[model samples]
Target: MKQQSGFTLIKVMLMSTMASVVVIGALKETVIQERLTGNFQKDMNARLLAEKGIFTAANNLQKIVSDNSSFSVDDLVNQHGLHVGNGEIGDDTVYKARLSKSAEGLLEITSLGQRYYGDANQQLVARFELKPADIKSPFQHAVTGCKGVNLSGSGVVDSYDSSKGPYSETNRDSSGHVNTVIGDSSVTITGNSPIKGDVKASGVIYLKGSSPIIGDVHSNTGVEISGGGGTSYRVEGNVYSGGFFTHRGGEVKGYVRAVGNVEMKWGSKIINANNDPYDIMYGGTGNFPASYHAQESVQLDDGTTRQNVSYSDAYFRKTPEIEPVKVYDPSSPDYDPAKPNKECDPFELPLNMPDVMEQNPERDQDFAVGATQTYMFTPKIGRLMTSQVGIKKAVALDSKKAEIYLFDNLSQSHGISDTTEERVFGMKNFKVYSDGKMTITGGDVIFLVDGDFVLDGNAKLTIKSGSSLTVFTTGKVILGASGQVITEKEGMTSSGIPSLNFFSSYSGRDGFQVKGASDMYATIYAPLTQVKLSGSGQLYGTVRGSIIDSSGGSGVHFDSALKDVNFGSGGGSDEKSQLIFKGWFFEPAKPLPDLETDEGETSNSDSGSTDD
Candidate 1:
């Protein structure tokens, strides 16, 4: 009986031991499953964080490319990498990003994401391609007024394609558009002059007298047309006004659209291109009244009367921003006033006076006072500096290439053939009394004038064929009565107009003036000054300024070839080029070293991945 009881006790102990082993195995399996699920969740979160890092890095790169034209994607590879944000997200998740250039010459952005607590990590790479952005030419119009424009007298505003030939009636087109960008400014066209192009203004546009606008007229504020003296004032193209449209004694040969009221006075009519009466469309809810004289009615082509109409499609566009002028920076390492490819910005001159004086100290001399002095120049004497040059007698320049810097004003009086008169005037108090026939020949020449430039009384500045002249001034420029700037020679098939260029940095009113019967064949760029064309002076190339005032019988002719000219690298906005996203990919998750410390805590530092 004792042996049997002992056997029962042994069997019970063995069963109890087996039950304990099964329960321990089941608990161990449950713990392993939970740990697997937790690790899977951590891996997904790290991957999502890596994607966020890639997108953020790409966004930053795009902005940098858009804001700076000189910025290149290669700069990123040189700098190794750029950090994205603070690199830390909530719940102990962190990310790191770097931009580099791939072997295919494309931009590649790499990102690493990690969760320190679980020791999970992810990596991704994105690629991008570079493309040129859409850029517009700065000189898209005949005359661009940064402030305002005034077209008075009988001066005609017209256009001609110099790429085709010189100005002729058959070679002309209606592309001579004039505009004023200032919202408070206006474009005033008065007298009997005819504008053979479109007129656009941000504010009001005033058209007075018997002048005719051959193309469309668009004004953001209002349009006023008034005529008298039995003259037929006309606008041959469509008229669009954001405000009221008033016609006193003129004719509109096309449709008229206004956001405000439309008024037509006696003898004023609206017609189509075929001279048939057309309806006026207005969007204003106010009353629009029309008045006519006794023998005149609103007659249509079918001999029927027509009435004005209303429209819901009448809309006004926001004014476009004007293109700013670009100037040179002296502090730049690539600063070269003679080179046209240098980068520049606004309010800075291309040439620095101090640098010029320092480089050509031996070339400094006073103005010579004698009989016609002839100066020959080679590469050794390519640069010269003078103070206040007054040309009385004839002065001849023969050069291969040269640059002349004038510290003060340059004045030229009437020419005199008598040497005795020159000597006598020289003996007297520095008063010039000789002919000012300054002739330039041989090669290209540039002049930098610090003060005013006055050419008057038969002062002739002749630029011979095969040679060009460029003038840069900081003061007023005046071509007075009987003054002539002859660029075109007899029997030349092509015009010499492109060879002469005038650039003024003056910021005052009437900074550039052309008086009397002088004819100018040059392009003028004076963004901060006022360009005035008085008397019968005719300008043949494009002109850009703060204000353009033409109050003479002669006109302005824009050369279409000037549109293809490139001034330099920097101007207006910096969005000249950009990059485009191509594709992206995920890299294999690199094994992260266990960061668990002895205190049963995870380390914050991610030392597994290195920046490249």
Candidate 2:
């Protein structure tokens, strides 16, 4: 009995030892599970923080697209990142973001989020992208006329990419592509000059003399080249015309295409840039060599057969596929403002000019002393005021102040012809600061003329550096033969300076100007006015009006720099500027090493300390 009792005791001791081991193992497993849960929670919190950073960046980007805001990611958030509250499962949670612009005008953004629970930490990252809405403008072209364009005499048209630097008559631009001349109607090139740009016209294109075109010339109507020496009249690029293309004597280095007849005179030739046979297209029937000169088989407008007809039979065939060039007329109900026009609509002003009434100026300021001297012409009733008078002080006019002249009714009795006495108003010598200096305050200084403005006598409008002048007239702007205007700013002799904007109302005397011997750089926008540049006048920048006429000695240079000028919000539907958003993305999340305790052990705490 004693032996049996001893065996039972041993069994009991062994069983108790096994039970203790199992309990110890269970406790260890619980601790490991808790640590794993803490780590998973921290990682998830970091990812959420990263997502929040992306959201914030998106909002800021939208703001920039809506308005002209700074494109800095740091500006959007505090140091390109924001600290939310405490992490869900960790401490010291924060997310940061950054912005960068690409050469293709793309906006890129990146964000990172991090969380810390004691010594353990986790991180996540993301990225996004954006683009500009509109980039169209009439200014992109060197010269664009709504009506027709006529290049006569020794007139020359060339191009300079201002993106390179200032343009000079001596140094041409580096943009391999030449300046472009687009006329909605006809484009007439005459004289022994040359055009260093592409020419496009919806109407007919008439080329005369030994004029050389460096770029392509395209017309919807016909292209007539009449001159001697095929080499003298050379086209470096292709030539396309919808109607009959009649070449008297010209050398085309590129393809020649015409919807109608292709009449090549004796010296005319066509070749590719490599001096090899090139392509040729003719929609209408015409005389042709038995064997074509094209590198490839000459294709007809029908897209079916090659030009394999005999010269004798190649007379009057028509191709129905070719369409005529559509001309742009503002009067057309389907007119598109985004499209170019041949002439400025008389009823519609240039989109550049702000529609502000001069009679009631938006910004009015009284002239300060030494800035201006007002002269009043208050004629007695029934009496004529006729006199050649003007102010030729050596005083330099202040651009901060305007010289406003008030006059009574400006009109002459219809029945009273001979009586210089019956003329109610007439100033023969109405001049302001003639032969004197004018100071531009870096801001716009307006000259408001209530009656007819005649820059007579030796009246010379001289401008100073960092200044701009604007002449707002309710009447006519007449410049006498002796009158002159010039600028001190180099490369800006006319009113083309950002400070000068000559605005004339449609109601005024048809915007008539007889300017001569003047070196002025200005953007004259008088759609109803007839602007004539005579007597060796050299004008730079853009000019738009009812009729633009220049003499042989006069010249007009279009400064490519004018494209950068903000001529007020553009007119028409397609003129307004805008922006747009592109898309978003998620980058692979980069994990950070887990923070550990001083003893190199992971901290798995139920409650973690928060980073203030």
Candidate 3:
């Protein structure tokens, strides 16, 4: 507008430069904001995919309630949008769907999905709450992934016969045999001695006898067992029983697991090896052996239909994660160096040993020839009951050789008593290797031991229930039973080693000892009172005591959360994966009918725990 004056070259250049700078800055800001928005959109979509999949599954489950049809993970993936093949983020991968119990009387169907990059991975999870809303009027939802398999009412057999081929609903021992048409099927039991064959029913199964069981029993829908009356019952499969497996007075063989709760009725005992001599069911997977009682009592979910049921204020979940490591012997070819290339053999003496090493007749070829000093006890064929480890005041160990050492270390026993101390064996010596399998059988034995002994390999040892074994600081002598009739020699001792010390009434006056066990991974299966964990190992049983201790064994550790434990101090001690003790902190044991305790505890005489 000023008309006529031509702009200067310098001004023109400056204006252009400023304009370019401003424009570039604005462009950069816009680009950054756009990128952020796009990322947010992508994240939102993925989240919706996960959540929406769950919602879709919930809606699809309409058919399951209507039909009660058994469903699997594949069915859920295909029918529901959970495993949507058209997922934008790589090929969609879905994990298996498993059914578990919910707080309410419902089933929880869930799935785990994941996507993997070079080193980074993302996991997506979805869950559906399934409740049998209408047991009768089963209807399916519009959701594709949802389906149903109808299972309701009592399971019964119209007629059963093991002898005449078809156990027709004719004349049979009607004592506990229920001959009725449950739901839409007829049920019958043959031979009368408590239905002892393969059974597939829609409803309840009412069989009689004193724990009447011969072979493995399986049920597809559900099973409700009253008293065993002493009959033995073995169930290899899961008891999806709408009711709990209650045994007022019955014993179960094999494993009696359920989709619900595992509990016992009135006066019952769930012992690893005791009482029932001939009652046991075998033939299954894993190292679990035969003749071990598997049933004391188990309840279904809370809402499960049952005649009568009892509940514990606390949940006793005893999980025994056993690392069955063998005792390594370097003398043999199967030697693995603790530290790579550290060639040291314990079983075989060094060639540099003085002439005195070879001439000892008692320790001749048999001891020196094979994998000896630095040997590991590899697992052979054996089965160990992980549920409950029996403890006692007195313990017994079988000698690997004619003469073995004994210590004051804890072992798998019943428990210890107060009035009997000097009459028992105290842990003192060191070189006692029962190969990790120490059986305490003598009556009311006592011990005072030192140091923590680790049991190598899958050592199988049984201990008396009511005996006691203690550990010592300078560890006392490895004393045996009365007049040392038990004949437990002293364990091998190292120059310097730490130990555990206890002189309480349970362990007694003479105290307990830590027997000499070099390549030992000893598992003390008992109602643990006080423990001093050393070395890197695990405790596989229950500890019903005032306090749980993890004082020593820097690298040595163990976990004793197998039995539902209580922590008075609400504390936790974990060193890597070696030791984890879920103790019954000041909590008393559940009052079981078959297993009772002394009144002195409640009355405050021999009361309180180590923590106090």
Q: TM-score per candidate, in order?
A: 0.59, 0.61, 0.18
Decreasing TM-score order of the candidates: 2, 1, 3
lDDT of each: 0.59, 0.49, 0.27
Number of backbone collisions per candidate: 7, 20, 161
Runs with alpha carbons beyond 4 Å of true place in candidate 3? 1-7, 69-84, 87-128, 133-612
Candidate 1 CA-lDDT value: 0.59
Deviation from truth (RMSD, Å), model 2: 13.1
Residue-level lDDT tens digits of model 3 in 1-612: 677566587789999999999999999999999988765654444343333333333444554433422233333333432222123444432222223333542334343222232112122333334322211110000000001111111212112222222122234221111111123221222122332223333334443333243333333233445553433433222222332344344444444433333445554333323323212222112122132233333333464433212223111222222221112233557554432111111111112112322222222111110111122111111122122233211222321111111211112222334321123232333232232334343332333223222332333323333222332222222221110111121111121111111222122222222222221222221111222322322211111111222212211111111111111111112211111111111111121111122221111011111110
Model 2 accuracy (lDDT, Cα): 0.49
Error of 1 at 26 (Å): 4.4
**Consecutive 10-residue window with the lowest summed lDDT within model 1:** 422-431
Distance from true location, Cα of 281 in model 3, Å: 69
RMSD of each: 12.9, 13.1, 28.1
- CA lDDT of 37 in candidate 3? 78
Candidate 1 per-residue lDDT, tens place, 32-129, comes to: 99899888877877787677777676666676666544455676444425433323445467666666788888888777777754398888888987
What lDDT is reached at residue 313 by model 2? 39
Among the numbered candidates, top lDDT falls to 1
| Clash count (model 2, backbone only) | 20
